[model samples]
Target: MSPMETGLIGIGALFVLMVLRTPVAFAMLITGYFGMLVLEGSRAAGAVMLTESYSTVSNYNLIVVPMFILLGNIASAAGFSRGLYDAAFAWVGRFRGGLASSSVLGCAIFSAVSGSSVATAITIGKVALPEMKRLGYQDALSTGSIAAGGTLGFLIPPSTGFVLYAILTEQSIGRLFMAGILPGLLLMAAFIGTIALIATINPEAGPRGARVPLGQKFRVLVQSAPLIGIISISIGGIYAGVFTPVEASAIGAGLVLLLAFAMRQLSWNGFCRAILETVRTSAMLYMVVIGANVLNPFLAVTHIPETLGNAMVGLGLGPYGTLAIIILAYVVLGMFLDGLSMLVVTIPIIYPVILQMGFDPIWFGVVAVIVIEMGMITPPVGLNVFVVKGVAQDVPMTTVFKGVMPFLLAMIVSLLLIIIFPQIATLLPDLMFS
Candidate 1:
């Protein structure tokens, strides 16, 4: 059989394994390994597997993954996430739909420290949901805000999604992190606007909470000092050129650890749990990276990217048209695939096409992340929606999904704005590196 045909069949097998509930990393690994054996003999396949496994794990740049994950896990264990929510609530809770807005802001801030969308959603949901509910916020708005807000974790600085994308595409991690900042803040603003619109239309869906006194607001801000300090040190230092991405992550993790201990917020057992969680999460990411690397070689042998890129160029749809198609595919696949899986599996084939089209890699990274954010709130496999549902037991899954619809629109709008103004994603990195 032709290499292209073999590649097609291998793709099918990968999907089949996924549909059978196999983990994404294993599916990619298995498909890539055997496909290579078919295309280049067993020796090449074995060598690729062994080389990717060792190379991926041993790459020093990858240390950022575990360090960032550890920072997040430590922040969660220390209850810093709650402090973030409280501080946001103190500032915005008195306005209409303030609680919901607070949830978005809180998630955005927490996302700076915690890299996982589900973790952001779960942590903020636990803090925001009860307050919104007690203040008579509608279930839809309450659940939807947290669900949508959680997705910010994928685009904000320290995002695991961006890390994986950088690894797959060989982009600069620090630049990707910087590119994410403006887009993240823009999307956060869009979510806040959506909440305002919702509250304006149906006041009962999100009632204003009692205003926080000036003194109390200051007190809440004080409580959030540790979170602010960590974000400033890690993300701030990266932009300031005071630290590399890996160094920033290490510093962030260490500072958070020290803060947690100082505040007595984390028990010794909690610290252990945090460390274990980081290891588990890091191992999973490593496996996926290794699998993607292995799969990339087989895809190269098949010339699938070249085949597809040529076909796309032949169609004369232009770069923008081609990009629109890719984004649409992401929206559709997101309904069934986890965001990370979608990112790793497709980037190897698609990224080359994008670069060939003359798009900025950093800008596209931001755009790709926003598309993944939509998937996190889209129906069927909206991971963040389900995470919020776990926190809001009485709220149906449909309600949470429905609530996120507006924010999803907001996200699309934010994406279009970024597309029109690439600087939104590039300005920070450009300025920083300059």
Candidate 2:
């Protein structure tokens, strides 16, 4: 059989494994190993697997994964996430739909350290949902805001999605992080606007919160200052060329650990749990990287990416037309696949096409992340939806999904803005680096 045919079959098997509830990392590993064994000898397959596994784990940049994860885990354990929510609530809770809007702001703040959608959702949802419910906010608005806001974890600076995308495409992590800044803030603003419109249309859906006293607001902001400072020093330092991402991550983690101990909020048990969770999460990400590395070689042998790129060029769709098609494909895949899995699997194929069409890779990374963020709140496999539902146990899954629809529209609008004016994603990186 031809190599392309073998590649097609391997892709089918990969999907079947995922459908059968196999973990994405292992599924990719299994498909790649067997496909390589078929195309080459057992010796070649074994060597590829061993080398790729070693190389992925040993890569220096990957250390940021565990450090950032640890920073977030430690922050959550130490109640810093709660402080952030309180601060956001104090500042914004007086506006119409203020509680819900505060939840979005809270998620965006925590996202700076967490670099995770599920983590951001769970952290902010735990703090914001109960308050919104008690204040008579509708379940749909409160829950939807959290779910949609959680997606910012994927778009903001220090994002895990950008980290993996950078590694996969050999783009600069700093540049990708910088590129994400404006787009992330834009999406956050769009989410806030959506909440305002909802409250304006149906006042009862999101009641105005009681105004916080200025002193109380300042107090809560003070409580949140440690995290805010750390995020600024780490992410901002990278932009200023004062530290690389790796150094920034290490410094951030170290600072968080010290702050936790200083506040006496991190019990020994909590500390241990944070470490264990960090290891588990980091190991999973590393394995996914390894799987992608292994699978890439097998796919190269099949020339699948080359063939797909050729086919795309044959369509005679100019750059924007082809971009629309690619974005549509990501949206469809996002419905079924976890965002990270979608990135690792499709980027090798789609990225070359993007470059060939003269789109900037850094800009495309921001665009790609926003599309994946949309999927995080999309139904069926909406991971963030499930997370918010888990926190607001009484809320139905359908309610959470329903809640995110407006915010989903907000996401689509954000995507369109970025596409129409690529500068939204590229300006920061260009100014900082150039």
lDDT against the true structure, per candidate, is 0.93, 0.93
Identify the runs in model 2 with alpha carbons over 4 angstroms from their true place: none
Give the per-residue lDDT digits (tens) of candidate 2, residues 60-92.
998899999999999999999889988988988
Error (Å) of candidate 2 at residue 184 is 0.6
- Each candidate's TM vs. the true structure? 0.99, 0.99
TM-score of candidate 1 versus the correct structure, residues matched by position: 0.99
Worst 10 residues of 2 by lDDT: 304-313
Q: What ranges in model 1 sit over 4 Å off?
A: none
